[model samples]
Target: MAELPDWLRSIPPWAFVLGFVVLPALGFPISLFYLTVGAVFTDPALALAVALACMTANMAISFAVARLLSGPIHGLLHRRGYPLPQLTASTEWRTIVLLRASPLPWLMQSWLLALGGARFLPYMLVGAPVQSLVGAGMVLVGESLFQGNAVWLMMGVTAFLLGQAALTAVRRRLRRRGSAY
Candidate 1:
């Protein structure tokens, strides 16, 4: 793995965390790509840090996408005279929480939420942990692969997928119940 610059190494953990939470929101895919690479090649501690950073970045991007869609996207749809319902109204906290917890694609979830008007803070709060878990799992999978433990690597991937599936099911159940209220 390429060593980070002295400047980056000198950055405090809190600053790294904040940067992770902000840059991705600004649509910088390079940060996510670099973090993924770091997670793949670095030691576990560094890999974990990279994974967390990437996940944080993802959450920020998701929140931004959701917020933007809430306004401009809504305006565009209205201007087109489409029969679509107001997407902004569907972006309730409960919906965002459920989506964050579910197995649906992250980018898709972010786009939908943004178009639906979910608030940034709530989305970030709900998404950060979930994304972190996913990112950490990815790092672990890479480590297992590097160790030439194909069996263990496969197991890790399977477990990750299964956990995501289970979470998605639970989120669906919660959504159904919430909607019934």
Candidate 2:
């Protein structure tokens, strides 16, 4: 096992809680924290449990905030002569997931979906779990790093890459379908 970094070693529990909530909402990179948890803790299960909880909470809050800000943002863009395409209310779950999973910056995903009038249920149900898979892979990466095992590290990295590839494929398919009309 690896020694925990000094900052992470001394971090308080409340800090972890807050980081989980705020970091994702702000689109901050949190893999380090996830890695630290995986490295320092003796139990991989516990690390995963806490990491996922934080990720879920962060996604929930960020999604809600984007939803709340959507109207204002649209209005601002409209006034500035950049009218966004109004998404139909009948948008399907696949559409929502595909849009949310596009190859954009992390924070933009939330805003784009909210602006497109994505339903809260679908974002939570369809998008978040898939999104969290990446984070879970990240946690696994941390675990591997902590353990200093080449095989486990390679496996974790490969899984994360595969997940990324899958997301890219889904986004591309969605784009092609979207343009077919």
Candidate 3:
């Protein structure tokens, strides 16, 4: 396997933790952290927890920032011809889940949730778990791949595929039931 760069090796654990929590909110590619955190932290479970916590923190930060700049963001989107979703209490949960499940970037998801007027309670409740779970799986899969462990890699990929299948089933059911998210 390839060795981590000297600069990466020199970073302290605390700095890594802080970077994991802050950089994504600043529009850094979160997958860089998700995929490499295992190599830094060593312990898979601890790495998973740390990634989840950082992701949740990033979500909150993104939402707060989006709320603070809602007017400007709305104007920008309006100029770009993108219509914001109307998130009612009834649709907020599903919409939040769908957004989390979508392939959109982390910051975009949070911004949409906040700018679309999702309630704080449902946003955290539905958004955090869904994003965290998907992110944690990425960490696990990444860890196994980096470690060259075929079994764990297969398990992670299988679990991810199953999760995607379940999500697709849920989407179909909602569509069949005429639930507008």
Candidate 4:
């Protein structure tokens, strides 16, 4: 809730971009980056592009961290009588979509999927776009608020609702099919 530091406001744009790519791994709130992008960038499309790229990079980093720690975490969990779920190929993308669409924080989703043995290709392919949609919505909403543009606000709201609706539809289908997430 605090305002960004004065220095942060003055940094070169490239530094902001670099921060976007690196800060989330250190527990910085990515939503801050998302919300701030609109105010910073002159072009909405460029803002959205940068936000998506940053989000994807953050996801990749989280996944790599999860991969590095997976063996130790898996062993620890097993010793404690808990085991991470193994995602089968058939259900992998579906799972990724669901988690990406769910309310879980972006970092958590990446970590969960990577820890669960999600393949890198599928994880990036399926998760990035879906998650990017969410980030795009945030960027839109941020831009709208910063610019006081009602149209962009509505678009952002619609994007968010559509994501939720898709998640709901997928869950219903899975339920009917007698499959559980």
Candidate 5:
């Protein structure tokens, strides 16, 4: 909750994008970046957008790295007679969303989903929107808290609730689709 350095405030926009990608991709905690984006960006919506884009890139890159390693790990484990977890096609989206929204640390959630057997491209496509919706709420809340304003706090709450509702609807629809197929 301490003041951010004046230098941080002066950071270029692309640095934010790169920071979000590199920090999270390397397994550094990302909530702080989201929180910093929340505190720094004057526009809550814009902050969310930046955070979401960075987070999406982080997820894709980190997941890709893990996924690339997984093949070898899978082979080794299989040779040793271990069973890897598998994600059914229908439940994949639901699982991804739930894990992304869960209270687990960001890196943990990403790694779990990466290993859950969802197709890479599909997970990337579906995961980005869900991450953005939830991440935007977090940024809004962070913005409100940093600014110490009651009105902003209310807006943050509203944004968070709306995002959750949208995510729930998405999850339900995914389930229904899963069942139908």
Candidate 6:
């Protein structure tokens, strides 16, 4: 990846805290990318801390975005000629939970929440720990892989991702069935 701009580096530590730390809480993808990159280049401890912090930020942002977009998102979906069955259905809680618990890409959840107009508070409440745990696990696996422990690292990451995918698929199926109730 290209180096962060010198101007970005020149920004005060507080700026990094606000942009990377605070903004990500709002479900911004940049934060996740930043955390992952940091994990790749830094020590595990730092990576873990950054991942936790990013997760916190993601929750805060998701909540605020969800709350604010509730009406607008509904309207936009209507205008865009898309079905609201998934978004407006009562399946959000389960869907969000499964998404959070899964090892699928973090951005998928963030985008779903953002675009679906899910409730911000609930999304954050559900998504924070899920993202954090997955992220930390990814970092740990990455570290091990970097250290030449390819078997363990590959196994761990594969297991986590597969588990997440299974859970998400099952939750989606259940949600679809529940919507018929």
Give each model a TM-score. 0.60, 0.78, 0.89, 0.89, 0.78, 0.58
Compared with the true structure, what per-residue lDDT tens digits does model 5 show for residues 1-181? 5456344578886777788888887777887787778655667678877788788889888898878888887888889998577899867877777777677887777777887687887678877776676676667667777777777667667867887797678768866877531
Model 1 residue 57 CA deviation (Å) reads 2.7
lDDT of 2 by residue, 13-121 (tens): 6787787778767877656666666644547788878877876777678788887887788899999999777556555466665654455655677667766777777
Off by over 4 Å in 6: 1-19, 22-41, 86-90, 101-108, 114-117, 145-181
Best model number under lDDT: 4
- Name every residue pair that clashes in candidate 5: none
Model 4 bad stretches (over 4 Å): 1-9
Cα displacement (Å) at residue 26, model 4: 3.1
The candidate with the higher TM-score, 2 or 6, is: 2
- lDDT, each prediction: 0.59, 0.70, 0.81, 0.83, 0.75, 0.59
Point out the higher-scoring one by TM-score: 3 or 5. 3
Q: Which regions of candidate 5 fall more than 4 Å away from where they truly are?
A: 5-7, 75-82, 166-181
lDDT of 5 at 55: 87
The lDDT-based order of candidates, best leading, equals 4, 3, 5, 2, 6, 1
The count of residue-pair clashes in candidate 1 stands at 1
Clashing pairs in 1: 66-114
Local accuracy of candidate 6 as per-residue lDDT tens digits, 1-181? 2344333436565455566655554445543444343434455577567656756775666556555665777788789997455455466666677667744455556666666656666676666655665666566665564445576477547746765775667667876887531
Off by over 4 Å in 3: 5-7, 75-83
- Per-residue C-alpha lDDT of model 4 across residues 73-164, encoded as one tens digit per residue: 99999999999889999899999999988877766777789999899999999988788778888888987877778988998888888878
- Give per-model CA RMSD: 5.9, 3.3, 2.1, 2.4, 3.4, 5.5
Candidate 6, residue 56: lDDT:
75
- Superior candidate under lDDT, 2 versus 5: 5
Instruction: Mark the regions of model 1 whose C-alpha exceeds 4 Å error after superposition.
Output: 1-41, 65-70, 81-93, 101-105, 150-155, 158-162, 165-169, 172-181
lDDT of 1: 0.59
Ten-residue stretch with the least lDDT total in model 2: 1-10
